[model samples]
Target: MGDGKSSPNPSSDGEEEVRREMPAKKKVVVVMGATGAGKSKLAIDLASYLPCPIEIVNADSMQVYQGLDVLTNKVPLSERQGVPHHLLGTVAASEEFTSKDFRDLAIAIIDDILARDRVPVIVGGTNYYIQALVSPFLVDDVVDDITACSLNSSRELKSVDSCAGYERLKEIDPVAANRIHPNDHRKINRYLSLYESSGVPPSSLFQGEAAKKWGRADCLRYDCCFIWVDAALPVLDRFVDQRVDCMIAGGLLNEVHEIYKPNADYTRGLRQAIGVREFEEFFRYYFSNTMADGTCVCGNCSAYNSEDGTPSSINEYEEALEPNFLEILNSNDNNLKVLLCESIDKLKANTRKLVRRQKRRLNQLKKYFGWDLHNVDATEALLSMPCCLL
Candidate 1:
């Protein structure tokens, strides 16, 4: 469905002046929480009662993938309670989604709503994503080869080469060691790499830029509303149990079994969603074992098991436009394309501004953008973003 909104009416002081037209104002409400956090249920509830027509903006990392809704724990339309929603199940499972893409899409849809005058209610708790939707990327830590080697191999750290790197890191960026998990050889190696190459500690580089970047809202030049959902731990845990049960009921086991293969790329985009990975492991190594010996422990299985996610994959890619712009650019109808392109560009830009505005409030809390947060850049070498963002 689309945004249903009316144009805004802005009045100016009477000075015998000609009246300029007013534009529709965009407003958003975001529902955030971890899995099983009742985000969808709450969003639909708000949409039903609010004076403004409510549209849901999906912030879940996995639900954007077209057909994998079952394992991702997506709320069905029957479950949406008649509110018009956008951007859920919009992308094909085979495609890659970046937070940048989601940020752009959310902006566009919100603009469409504002043009008509409706409220956009963003839902779901892809935590980092909730931040990224509102803020720019920050690079904090230095990642290097030694960290990679150490994290990869569970080898002795006192080895001469590893110790040398450790000492070097201690001297240049001691705080980095303090911050990262001591057992996390990957991070240690990265800090050492930064120390080796830059001769400066990772801590020094991202101090301001590292975090606390969200300044005051309203002050940032926008009229907006922010709502945060804090579900209790016990309640959230129960919700998770129910959600996992639902996934199993929805054929998540078969889904995992289908993807369980040596040739299968479990690391592929939507396939790496949380439950997908767990069950994939359950199937490949654990399933046959369950049938053969009936247990989860495999002392002899190969060591590809990792709890880290398919962050790179589990996002919505850019959606295609009406193609009129391309046709115009091709001189096949140039005038129409230019007009549409300009219009779409403005909408997307305004949406991005609003998203950035929202990120500031969420960032200030520090729970969502906590010191415990990990930087995406340090994890990967590419220009990429989380689906929601932190």
Candidate 2:
């Protein structure tokens, strides 16, 4: 998230005025894909071909939080090309934002856009947020209590033993525990909330008819069409690799350090975003020369060095990190390079996992909510989705 209030494209004011004069289309087009697959570009380009003026509604959960702009991959305002965008970098990073919160706010935003007679194009990689908007699967009837439980859990989890909450979740909902990673605090908290609010575990609830029942007919709020920006796995892998390199080059570490609050648990709020947690080890290395969580391993070696700044090259990193290399019997420049390379490799690995999860969710959309997705090859330039889709 960034510091200031979110801005609309200043160049689009005149066109937006004209758009307000037209009749409401009351229609929606949703763009979904893995990160770095050009979902934002597709949304911006798709707006141009639509007969009615289309305003973008962001569905990406990370981008909704303010600051960490580069890590979140916020579409540069210049790239917006005079199209109005909503909900980009609107929440502070310290705040807790959830899919249900997005769904309610998006509903109101869509209504406002419809009243102004403009089209709303929903774009983001967060399929969960999109699902909340298009389906009643997470209706307020259920979410209100869940939200209360979440607040209670947030408070309770902090004071009690950390593992206690996770253990309780496993004891009550082992099926959910099996599905969720032990380290994933967000899912643990959510599963616990579900148990607390509903007095039923997710495994049984998921198997119930109510959870299984969802369709287009249930979406009485607005008509929806989903466009999936598709790319081959090899192509996506290349894109992800290039994107990871760019993010690191663009000072993603600095950004992470700036917003990172120590002791911030991933189970609550925006800290769970990939870069913030992934760079924990790197940040420790940067701030404290010793790799051992601020503990100096060497008894006689000086722990502090003037070369504590961000290293531009492997040589610089090697020189700055020498003190921390005392543990290695025959530490050399090559050894330090290998350690640094491991950090980058870890970042790339985490990013690939995120991309795979996103694609898996996209594949399961139809199965979960009966959403028929139109596929678009994003690598092709000058491509346009069929505007006739409603």
What lDDT score is found at residue 233 in candidate 2?
73
TM-score of 2: 0.71
Instruction: List the pairs of residues colliding in candidate 2.
Output: 1-65, 1-66, 1-67, 2-66, 2-67
- Give a tens-digit lDDT track for model 2, residues 1-390: 568755578658777887799564357899999877788888898867999898999998889988888788888787788888898999877777777689889999998997898989999988767877876666333534555656453443335344687788778878666444444455566666666655667666445554665334344245677899877776666667777677766666557656554455655556767767766665555444443333333333233332543334434323332233323324443543455567667877887887788888787776655677898876543133321110
Worst 10 residues of 2 by lDDT: 381-390
TM-score of each: 0.52, 0.71
Q: For candidate 1, write residues 36-66 as lDDT tens digits.
A: 4345766787866789887788887678777
lDDT of 1 at 280: 36
Best-fitting candidate, scored by lDDT: 2
The lDDT per prediction is: 0.49, 0.67
Deviating ranges (above 4 Å) for candidate 2: 1-25, 143-187, 193-199, 204-209, 212-220, 290-339, 379-390
Query: What lDDT score goes with residue 237 in model 1?
Result: 38
Q: Candidate 1 regions off by >4 Å? A: 1-26, 136-224, 263-268, 285-390
lDDT of 2 at 201: 72
